[model samples]
Target chain A: MSEQGYHVAILGATGAVGTRIIEQLENSNINVASLKPLASKHSAGKTVTFNGQTVEIEEATPESFEGIDIVLASAGGAVSKELLPEAVKRGAVCVDNTSAFRMDENVPLVVPEVNADQLKNHHGIIANPNCSTIQMMVALEPIRRKYGLKQIITSTYQAASGSGQAAIDELIEQVKTYVKGEEMSADIMPVKSDKKHFPLAFNLLPQIDVFEEDGYSHEEWKMIHETKKIMKNDMNDTELKVTATCVRVPVVIGHGESVYFEMDNQDVTADDIKELLSHSPGVIVEDNPAEQLYPQPLTAEGKRETFVGRIRPDKENPGAFNMWIVSDNLLKGAAWNTVQIAEELVKRRLIK
Target chain B: MSEQGYHVAILGATGAVGTRIIEQLENSNINVASLKPLASKHSAGKTVTFNGQTVEIEEATPESFEGIDIVLASAGGAVSKELLPEAVKRGAVCVDNTSAFRMDENVPLVVPEVNADQLKNHHGIIANPNCSTIQMMVALEPIRRKYGLKQIITSTYQAASGSGQAAIDELIEQVKTYVKGEEMSADIMPVKSDKKHFPLAFNLLPQIDVFEEDGYSHEEWKMIHETKKIMKNDMNDTELKVTATCVRVPVVIGHGESVYFEMDNQDVTADDIKELLSHSPGVIVEDNPAEQLYPQPLTAEGKRETFVGRIRPDKENPGAFNMWIVSDNLLKGAAWNTVQIAEELVKRRLIK
Candidate 1:
């Protein structure tokens, strides 16, 4: 850590999220004295532009983080589990964009807007929450602050990009096949490593990630547990119950969520929730049904803000509300969120 | 009204659902001696093949049903409101696939699998429930019968075909635009006559129909109200509270729903639900996680049965469960359902 800005490293620098992290850093106000981009051996020697300078991605290893002050890792959970620890041992404060350390008792899962203060609690690594959970938290945190939240049931319309570059490329190829009247082939959706791969072009995959305990997909487990861990930290009294159904849609970017939530306060109204989110940090409320304005994936693509709309109370349940939340899965859900945490670390001086 | 066969008239025969109704009737075991394919003047004189004979589409007028014993209507809500009553007056029992008579006290909203008994109560017009509602009732009716039902919170992944043939074509056009790297121009989806239109290819439109009371779209309202009407007739004790968030995705056919329900029987397990559905009428259970088997829209397209899968008990809440239900929106949701009602009417000797 230097007074003349910190030495930074972008692990997984040649990947989709890693590439975005570099661009976000260049666009952001983060003053970087030096930048080192690191990826797997296959991606090493490839170059990516950071702050207008082409930085060569080096092979990621234990010594890759020797003099690095801040390390941003998104090379997958296994990579983060192995390399992020080594980086941490080398005196680097890492903000990991994988689930490797999210539920770790020591690592704080931070969505800067909702729980930036938790950065002070990180034990060398601050875990970034899942893409779906991060956006839901960004939109709900504002409302949860004003109206006491008790329960949440969310159904996600996730984009193909959340699976990484290959899935998006497969989706595009599938569309090409669909237009040509050929059967679209699939080897990369729902879960690439799973037994079956279905075509997501103009279709939906209800399963995201492999099946976990009790028939719930691992993606669902992440959403269910991550929400509890992130929310219960700041909240001390009420028990917040959460459930989720994670689905992968055909979109190349932007994840849309249909969230139904119940509040402890019975009198909370849609207008009250909308007005509050409009003023909250990192959230943009676009709800106006009369004009047919609402959050959509295409509109929110590549954006840094979480777009919230369709705020309405459940007609049958008094204290409950339903809303649609959309955000760029790679950006707000991954890169922008990761970058935000890095900025928070600098501002709070939590890192070296 | 003859013993040889009933004369069947397909109002709006040229439409997506209307065409399917004609096909369903041809594929059904119902005895049909003659076929009258009626549509607007625009589609008049268009030829449709039925029962191996070519039939010319006639303009749907009040007099179109004079010699018809049974009429299947799906032109539009307004067309049904104006012409269906006229057909009824002509002594043609009509099964309507529009919203005009669904809630009418005189008309019984029927999904024969769930409420065939209600079909006997229809005063001339039997309303086919909304496509989304039809599939949901088919899956849950069996569950409600065995395990006492209390509440439902559903989020839908609806297809563009639900808006009719034009929207489906628009979605294709939008997909073509997306592949060519051009901005997709959309003017059909969400709702044709609504204030705004958004592209559904590789994207999601949160608004399904025009916004109704409490910011819920008319589509959501239909799912809410129609579900209650069809479910309450069978069971009288428990109040079924239903709420929905209906979204239009890029798919051309099939609608998928994420349903969360609380059963009155606390100990109902996923195996119990899956076992019950496997034997349920007009329902298919495909819930195997290890093989990545579940109800997906692509596989459900063109199928008559409602496919249920991903049945899992809520990990956090006892007595609650989450499931995924998918069915061809045109067939099971509209055409096949209407045809089944026609068959039931004949079987019960209630028609003519």
Candidate 2:
């Protein structure tokens, strides 16, 4: 496999979801055989071009994962709780995208279209899930596999680059001091370590990440426990549910949810969940309603799919539904869902 | 009522919820014996100052309600369906803020803190309701009179001045053409006789009004038939339900809802609905999560009460809850809930 196609690294390579996880692993299919980048000693040597090489970044410690077989990280939950177990003890299989080892339990949070077979239960990190719970789990895990979901609630609209890139440069300096009528400076957003710091440009910030004692907000408890551990099945279902209310809207790079859900089979509709999210896999429907065409975050910003639509139904709540997702919260909510779980761990060989 | 105290008339007086209903009837108690502003002959003569005198606008018609005793009518639903029943055939008792007689059957719709006794069952127009259903009925009518609502499911976050003042001057000229990067214009917004015109400043516009045909949005079927007719009461509850999705953020004022409800008594909690919306009446809780507090939209913009907070309880739905409301969609959702229903039709004399 060394004809040159999988050495990776990337930790927080010049931030903002690490330069879109190096432009979603250069339009993915994984093969990069060497592109380290790391970051955070004031972005080490600062440089990052990737697939047309330029690389540089370098400061993440624990010896920047020796022979780097694949990492990716995102660098914040305490630098992925200290260098993702030192790059899983040097064997290097990371993926993270922060919230540290996502509810640990042997960490496999993933969202390769809602749990890509939980990447054979990764022990070498994996995590990823919250860019508002990976676009509401790639638009409700294909309507919970042809209808059976149970409950959802969401209400995000999230975007000021999910609080990074300096909260989208403080929401474009609070929309240019609210259009030069001055005084609109807020240090960061709803929660950059809380203690009050509002002004999200044309405002609306129902806190995202940092409250958690039951008033929910560690981004609404990571979209209610990473959506019940990526919609756990095998009837370990633990009765689905999920709740969120994340907010932070002054959009900048897509992230508009507004779900609603509820299914457990009530004879679904809304055009059968908009024809099952227009054929699932990283969803796209973009509903039509006489062509006003739904799914917008300014036309899903530098899109990478997941653009669902106002697939209505819940008028008075029958089988329920309500949709209107959108994506690109730094690409499919956090660098193409962590480079799509490292391109499904390099197409199932589980990343050697 | 004429000791210089009752001939109101502001029907879209130089627009934007009729100059905040002439600064909420100069901060209420209704005593304004003569303020007649009217409008639409392209804002007629255009003057507009009010209490400090000035006046001018006029041009409405039906001889501009001859001896007008009260009309308020926000000039739009075809000029409040042609001058609110000709200002109720000149005797005048209107209130409408336009959806032109909300679901009509005698028009009462009011939301004076959840239907001020349906304003003594109004017959000559009372309506007001939708500024996202009068701030989710002042933050869920004291949790539906202490635990018995049954079901909600909102998700608004409205405000481009709820599509009025030229959609808040087209959301501040599309946020100054999106921070000067440009190409940001859009006609009026999610709706203004919808034919698509997205670009809600920093963005997000999941249709606010106009779609209606079982895909909701006529501002979500006026928040599901005006919350079962302003929380109806009596066994006439007609199965509570409600539902919405509204959206149109890039706030220029307020409206933030996110609800989730469901009560009809499953033994409610979150401190019995935050000590009953902190003793109800125009609610103002502002929840405290260790001081990051809650109700946002830039601190509930130009407040007029209704600022509720992230109430909680629904970690996985047990009687269900989840709050966060906010207000000022043109003050208490449309100019102090249409001058608090014309000051409860002047303390219940039920108008002229």
lDDT of 2 by residue, B1-352 (tens): 5888898888778777788789878988878878888787876887978768787887888887888888888877897897788778878898887786788778888887766887887878887877877888887877777677878888888878877778888888778877778798688787776676877888888887778666666778778777787777322354787778888888888888888888878767788787878888888888888787778776777778888888887755678878888888887888888898899889989887
Q: Give the TM-score of candidate 1.
A: 0.98
Using TM-score as the measure, the top candidate is: 1
lDDT accuracy of residue B171 in candidate 2: 84
| Per-candidate TM-score against the hidden true structure | 0.98, 0.39
What is candidate 1's CA lDDT for residue B224? 87
Fnat values, candidates in order? 0.80, 0.86
Q: What is the TM-score of chain A alone in each candidate?
A: 0.97, 0.36
In the predicted model 1, the residue pairs found to clash are none
- Which docking category, incorrect, acceptable, medium or high, applies to candidate 1? medium
Tell me the RMSD of model 2 versus the true structure. Answer: 18.8
lDDT for position B56 in model 1: 95
Predicted structure with the largest DockQ when compared to the true one? 1
